[model samples]
Target: MTQPEVEPVSPRPSNLNLPNVLTTLRIVLVPFFGAALLVDGGDSGTWRTVAWVIFFVAMATDKIDGDIARARNLVTDFGKIADPIADKAITGMAFIGLSIVGEVWWWVTILVLLREWSVTLLRLSVLKRVVIAAADLGKLKTTVQGLALGLLVLPLLDPDLPSWLETPGEVLFYVAQVLLAVAVALTLWSGAEFYRGVWRQRHELRGSGKS
Candidate 1:
């Protein structure tokens, strides 16, 4: 018997919805990635390398999924919401795991995670009334985060990696650290703009008796 065909998540219809599948894959991989981090604890080279490879692939998926979704017109509310949540989970868990192993600066992880959570809350509070899509700065922030996380993850499991141009981990660490700081700034700025938009939307709607 032919099975029932399920509808895709996006309101826009397209068979080339690669982004949705990639986002789904990222969600599925988060737990395994966490487990790998635990197993690679205490700076074990082999396990760290394995963890990094998996993380790299997962991070790559983050970019690919979004691009595919946009290109294929499969941008759904589900993808809009869940994709960022999945990113934070994977990145946040690794940040915490890396700190636990004393590989990353604990304060750095705390600061970054705080920014992530704050911006997430701000977006959630306003997503319903406004389209809180990624601004250019936010997209740049994600790129910065992907690079920084890669550097951070590598050192946690394998310290031999030279992050930027031709520098060692120590040098690359600070560079990625700076980029993370910048990303946080961008996140906050963009978030505030989004909040203002939502506030305006709500006020206007209420004035029109639409709310």
Candidate 2:
């Protein structure tokens, strides 16, 4: 008699874990950060500084959550989906707020957001067919954007700050501009790379009649 075939079992996804909790916390902070920025009305004051602190903390959670998830083997489908959404929300708020407050140009915000969302949409479209992990270039892009936006969000330009800080802050702002430009370049480049990888995988699957 022939033996019965056994089906492979998938790992059960863990949702309620430390990483997911941190991820949720990051999402929750988004509104408060926006409120602070709006309340400050782009002025260099306590509220504006508070907003930056909120933003920084939120960003920090991103790194911590990912590390904890990987280290603890607590990765889940929910986390995979929620993490990117949270990231987009926080970063999107920063971009839009800066544009509204006349701190950053609208065009730059528009271009960066367009690329960011396009890549995200691509990921969703191919999620079933391929698992494309983030590339080094993608992480680099994120880091650069974080640094650039963090610097821009700071009220270091405020005259109330010490005279010494004003000069350094101005210099940091200029450096942030350069980083932003680099980030935009990497964003477009990495996006193209992702598309190429997806196309190749899809093509292979099609050739093998698995797609």
Candidate 3:
């Protein structure tokens, strides 16, 4: 017997949605955030506070956009492409700007950026072939990185802050540094895990092809 015709799949959601708008907004904010962070050679408490607020807003939108997209079934190719790029652009600016201001080591920023971009590019290249889900370690890395960067963006060591804040601010700065160190470790580990996952999936595909 002949089989019945299958219904056509629904078209993808439009790219011009709130989620995408938020993602684009995050990208647009990168330069402004960097400029604020670098004001007065990174010594302006007020500007640093402004930078921190921008960063926080950008990061908040990152989560908000993703949640909105998923909840409303508004996922699209544009979001798939722009979401990660937006994230990297903002965080990359923070890293580079921090290094420029001597808040973070140059080597650390270089290493993290290299890994982040390389992995992002590779993932996008294989987007059609591989469906590697975000691993727990990767999520942890993201969380730690965001927390560390956010804390560092504040003018915790600005020297011009209130005397009462000196001790607490100093403590927070050191804690942020420690979190950054942990984030670096997690970043490397997650990168390696991602590569291994890609390799295993490709190997399985090859093996199946031979059969």
For candidate 2, the TM-score is: 0.91
Task: Please provide the root mean square deviation of candidate 1 (C-alpha atoms, Å).
Answer: 7.2
Q: What is the lDDT of residue 44 in candidate 2?
A: 51
Candidate 1 lDDT, 2-118, residue by residue in tens: 999999775555433667678778878877766776773545655665667878888888888877777867777777777888788878877888778775678878887887887
Q: Tell me each candidate's TM-score.
A: 0.75, 0.91, 0.95
Each model's lDDT: 0.72, 0.87, 0.95
Please provide, for model 2 over 77-175, each residue's C-alpha lDDT reduced to its tens digit, 9 standing for 90 to 100: 888888988898899899988888887889989998998888887887788779898999999989999998888788867778888788998888788
As for TM-score, the candidate ahead, 1 or 2, is 2
Can you list the residue pairs that collide in candidate 3?
none
Cα error, residue 158 of model 1, in Å, equals: 5.1
Alpha-carbon RMSD of each model = 7.2, 2.7, 1.9
Clashing pairs in 1: none
Model 3, span 24-80: residue lDDT tens: 999999999999999989999999999999999999999999999999999998998
Off by over 4 Å in 1: 1-17, 121-126, 156-167
